[model samples]
Target: AIRCTPPDALRALTRRQVDTAELYYIRGDVEKACELAAAAWPEPAGAEPPVRRRALALYTHTLLYTQGPAAAQKLVDDTLAQAADDPWLRSLALAFAADFNSAGDRPYARRIAVEAIKICDELGDRADPIAAAVAPMALAEIDMFGGRGLDRSLIERARAAQSGQSWIPFIDRAEVHLGLSAKHVDDLGTSQAILTRTLRQAQDVGESSAMLILQAHLAYTELLSGRPEAARAALAAFDAAAREAGPGIGEPGSLTVSRALLAIMDDDLDRAEAILLAALERLPPIPIVRVVMDTPLGAIALLRGDVERAITLLAGVLEQARAVHVNEPSVRGRPEGDLGQALVTAGRLTEAAGVADELAEIGARLERPTLTGIALRVRGLIATARGELDEAEKLLGAAAQAHAASPMPVERGRSLLALGQVQRRRKAKTEARRTLQEALDCFTAHGHRPLARLAEAELARGQRAGAGSVLTASEQRVADLVADGFTNREVAARLSMSVRTVESHVASVFRKLQVRSRTELAARFKQ
Candidate 1:
């Protein structure tokens, strides 16, 4: 019976082996599988028809998993060259290529993914769920790069096709869920649940590497949920899993960088600095989310009053961010947003406002409320500095609403603080008090110690009206600038008026308020 085994049975054995290898490769056991597949490849000269082709495909994935995209590219190209007319080979080849391209320098990944998706769809019952998963991921990745709204149509297509599919589809589903959650941070519960399920499935199938990745995602989500301790625990779990699985288990540099951020959040500046420095030194030059990593590090440096380090890191990050195609989706518009914040802190309000404008436009297109709120807040601060109270009020109010819509408690609390400041300047003392108190409560609840402290300080100052109801046009201009918190020069340039005109307004406002300087005017409003 063994000697007389049917060709069909032999072919089935080969297919099962191929599938097994794929499972191992995806789970991060690339080195072991690749070596075994390489030796076992070149199937018996006259073996069943599908055996050789299946082995080639399996070997391609093994190479990809072990050596990354470049090696995978060669295997796909070679396979396509050999079997130019085979629909199965073509579909597999193109799908792998598209997956590689999706991570490449250009945006060609989406196009290739779509073509493969079409081929698979036309192939009907034989369609590969893996290809289907790649298609939408590529498309969504493209949409993210442009800072544009994601194509729900494509995402829905992937979701519909993933029903009862294999591990590949589930992995893809996890990615899609993460993308959506990133866009809508308020949907943390849904996102976390999706990741949890995906991780379980991956673990059940021995896809340890994928499980680790999903675990990291869950950790980050915990960070967003304001559970730093839980986030740390998750990261530690990932670290242990990674060590057990060995290398080839996806990137860990970013995870290490994330740990630094947690340390910073905990107010452990020494630990944060030590971790960041170590990770930065060990990480490869080709980093994933480089700008995002650099921006947070810069923020920490700035917080520690390491202005030189902040400038170096922030400026370097911004340059790289701008150098990119300006359309990659992973970091969203965070690079520009970070730069704007850095510029504002460095007293470059004009540059900050410009960047904020760009970020706002991008965020609007993406329908990401948190980013929009950030952009608006930056602009509002600029306006306040320019003495544009009316404009400041409008921008601040919009920012507050956007923050309220965001799922991030910390962001919401910060927005409340900024809005309260604007209201206080408007002489709406009751409203300001209410808003400020709400901010204090939110920050306190969220463990945002610094913001809560600031809110408390603002609330402790009794309210006072520095400017009267009936003011001259010049005084009105000054009031606007004062409320917006703009510099004299910025106000003049924005209004198309002279610096002397702005100064004259400020002088007149000082006389009316009987205040010595702008600082006194601001203090009076707060009091």
Candidate 2:
């Protein structure tokens, strides 16, 4: 067995270690990758250079992704100094450099990524195929989308470069494969099909440790894609797997998110808010969680009609999204779409138009049907608020048409109600009645009685205004609350509504009773 060694004998240990590090990296186990790779560096005098360079590269990559740029910068600077002549090592370090500045300097990240790609190209097809694959894979995530987000060609290149390469293992390929799959992960049918395959593949290969996290991801995907039953089942499976693996296992952060989404589905905002805030505190505010959880916390505020607070919450999430290179659409879509809605509700029409323009830019870049519909709906609201009836009708018509195809009924129902409001405002009584009736039908079909009543009141000459006796049930409650001298935020808390919506209801109370101040309303109620 010790008769003779191969020409690449010196590469044996470091090469195998790099392969194992890639496995940990793919599993989201950054610490393990760092641990394995940190020991492979400081290459011995006569060792093959690629093995030593790869270990240094992986150590930097893992450290950057997990601990962030500040923590890894010194190590990267030191290693690159030693391996300055190595094209493969330099390409990886530059890509990690792009990621390092991703939050602080996006323009710089693009510049660095371009340089990294050129270095990889210099290595060519015959030399350092793994770097050839990884440079583009890393670059694809950081490059400017020309407002179109990631280019398909770059993703294909990353996938293609990995072909016929023995340096990267099959297990390490899962992350790359799943990165592509996460695009369709917001749709039920497609998500389930793709996730099932991913889960099965992990299982077939006995990679159960990776499956623990994958199961939670599939569950979260199910929660978003409109399959609560399937989500519930996936969660159960995840719990079982997590328990079987013992304590401190899998990513429970996504589980917390799934629970919050479930609460949202049940119309339990109070519960959803509590869970979201708790998780936001407990988990690191990573890009994926910000997209999935933090944005929803703002949605809860918006649901309560707390438009100002919603804006504050969503603005922070959007800021992070712009800084980080999270190419997932769902991650970016929520804050952009809902921030516009919040502005519209706060009667900030000009600002709402700005938000709408931002969303339209996203829609143009992403070309997603749901986001495009929301942009249209928000634009229609801006038009309607400005009394541009004809333009509002055109925009609203397109919005309704787009929403009609959405998996989420709330979207379609919202567009219908908005259209009805425009019709009523235009004094198109017959059209208003039909449109409002359709809106009512939609809400009722979805078992949304409270929303249906809002539509019914719209059809009744806006009876929520002008007289206490004529006040709709909601308006009556708002009137009593106003009489009690409660502030908008307090009343919102009491009624599980937003402060802005409460302000609107209070304004209606003042109009109906012809009262100017809270004191006046309170005295009238005293009678």
Query: Best by lDDT, which number?
Result: 2
The residue-by-residue lDDT of candidate 2 on 335-427, one tens digit each, is 665677776656677877876777666666665666677889889877865668789988988988887766556566667787877775565
Estimated TM-score for each candidate: 0.75, 0.75
Model 1: residues >4 Å from true position, as ranges? 1-16, 26-28, 39-58, 121-126, 159-170, 173-187, 203-206, 243-254, 305-319, 326-333, 422-433, 456-527
Query: Candidate 1, 4: how far from true, in Å?
Result: 16
| 127-164: candidate 1 lDDT, tens digit per residue | 66555655665666555554555566766676765675
Clashing pairs in 2: 304-497, 304-498, 305-498, 305-499, 306-498, 466-512
Top-TM-score structure, candidate number: 1
lDDT of each: 0.65, 0.66
